[model samples]
Target: METLLSIIFIYIFVENFVLHRFFGICPFLGVSRKMETAIGMSMAVIFVMTMATLVTWLLYTFVLIPFNLGYLQIVTFILVIASLVQLVETVLRKISPTLYQGLGIFLPLITTNCAVLAVTLLAVRLEFAFIESIVFALAASVGFSLALIIMAGIRERLEMANMPDVLQGSAVTLITAGILSIAFLGFQGMLSL
Candidate 1:
């Protein structure tokens, strides 16, 4: 429907979790050094974000609110996110040792990624229906993946470009991220969602 399309567009381009809201900056910068690693991290993030959204939304709606235990929202959400990250870690370790190793600390760091937590909390706070929550989470994750891949590609190219010593390394990366953020900001008002 038009509403779903608006949700997807608004989250991906306008209110992007990474570029716009500035969540998950650690992995956004760390794993983005290589396209392969960025893709790996993005997949893990997408899985975790989507699953977390589903579980948390269900618990909040069916358990927490019904039981008048809404005060435990943050605690419950973190536990769900952390457990999901562990599942992802185990699966990645068994499936692709290279990516698992490449991700290193960043993979575990996804457990604490505010973006993951934010999506779940946002879905609940916005009172989104079950399907809307899934769509929102998927859109957010795709947006995050898009930003990560773009940053990785840019960083990879930047490694080859001749640049000043001052603007090299993290300096250039931060500058590039800022520029990308500004570009995403231009999407504002493009959609009313």
Candidate 2:
């Protein structure tokens, strides 16, 4: 169980897909202008990533590897991720137009979000067990959300705060993300994972 906990902690803090792995920076910056949009995108990512991990692991473990079809992982993974994103987009549009609208392009962008693909690839590459892969994906999603929400909050405040001209817009957002990434590094050596 400690290993599972370590995996969660590793993905969530020690090696966050956004801050540590540096994946999915596009939506991390593009849609993080508002807390609502950020939350919406994050939730979408969480579901998409977790589902992608589960499906990819199942296919790789039982079907692909068993059939000696390991070479098809990339193509299959992309297809699965894209389908999942489309399903999510449809559900969000029907269930809550507000959030759907807030998500905007970022919703569909999850299809191309390397973080989703990264989790699946890494899970297979590391040869993690099914449960371990699921846990890792969940933790990575949470970490992604943590970063997005934090950036949204910071950007929200920055909008009202008086700052230098150069520090406005993406400039300040990128700087804030860099600082947050460094702050996450403080967790280095905090765990044995």
Instruction: Looking at model 1, report the run of 10 residues with the lowest lDDT sum.
Output: 98-107
Q: How close is candidate 1 to the true structure, as a TM-score?
A: 0.90
The residue ranges of model 2 lying beyond 4 angstroms of the native Cα positions read 91-106
lDDT of 2 by residue, 33-131 (tens): 999888888988888899999999999999999999999999999998988788778887899887778665576788888899999999999989999
User: What would the TM-scores of all predictions be?
Assistant: 0.90, 0.90
State the TM-score for model 2. 0.90
In model 1, which runs have C-alpha deviations exceeding 4 angstroms? 91-106
Give per-residue lDDT, candidate 1, residue 63.
97
Candidate 2 local distance difference test against the native: 0.89
Which tens-of-lDDT digit does each residue in 51-98 have in candidate 1?
899999999999999999999999999998998788878887899887
Query: Clash pairs of candidate 2?
Result: none
Model 1 lDDT at residue 49: 91
